[model samples]
Target: MSAGHTAVTTPQPRPVPVEEPVIRCETPQDECGVRDLLDRLGDKWSVYVLVELAAGVLRFKELQRRIPGPVSQRMLTLTVRRLERDGLVSRTVYPTVPPQVEYELTEMGHSMTHLVKALSDWSIAHRPAISDARRAYDEAHPA
Candidate 1:
């Protein structure tokens, strides 16, 4: 090469772009009964009942007392029936002089203890933020 001249290099070819297959993983509908199960769990009463059951079994009257104020007796009964139907809780009847009955968590219900505990932990951890939000919202709405 001459001192004053520069050599030009040819451009390299770009690699062909690979087209990856779009894998459609199974959705909730793909499972036989997952949608129904999710619907049951999504209920507020169901989660509350499960949380209450975590402490151990209780009679209907006891559950009525432990749950927050003003829950109707019919509502509690329905929640128990739903939980029992979903296989997450068990209802036991004691055939004594007065037929005592109790409700407790089944194996599946026991499994949900961690999830309930997590929700409780989160409520405690974010209490200040929740309080602030409530204050701001109430101030703006003036109810």
Candidate 2:
């Protein structure tokens, strides 16, 4: 053992505390409602819309452009509508010749986005491990 050397350690980042109370499912009705909302929010299109809106407000066309795979117009419309219904997004329409419209995240939406962003960060950080697991599974089981 060296007498002069000291141990070194990496510093850790502080964690952000969750401020909002999670929705509780105490009854059958409550459980159904909560599950429905979660299902809608977890869908692929909804996640994409949320990611785009997290940046700032955007018109419908802008949302369409930002999301990859060029989500269909009907699908985009449906996704935003569902999010709006759930109070996570606000829609503003301007009375003009073309009827300008824009969508932005509500206060609650921002809170939800924080959680989504954390999940996204975690996914990116562990992508290598996820791929390795998938490859190992595929190799072990051939079609």
Among the numbered candidates, top lDDT falls to: 2
lDDT of 1: 0.83
Model 2 lDDT vs. the true structure?
0.86
User: Where in model 1 is the C-alpha error above 4 Å?
Assistant: 1-38, 96-98, 130-143
TM-score of each: 0.61, 0.73
Clashing pairs in 1: none
* Candidate 2 colliding pairs: none
* Residues 10-110 of candidate 2: C-alpha lDDT, one tens digit per residue: 34666887786665566676674667657766687998888899999999999999999869999999999999998989999999989998999999888
What is candidate 2's CA lDDT for residue 136?
A: 97
Residues 1-143 of candidate 1 have per-residue lDDT tens digits of 66445434445678998887454336655755546657766766777788788899999998888887677889989989988987889999999978898999999889877866787899899999999999999999996
Error of 1 at 75 (Å): 1.0
RMSD over all Cα atoms, model 1: 12.6
CA-lDDT, candidates in order: 0.83, 0.86
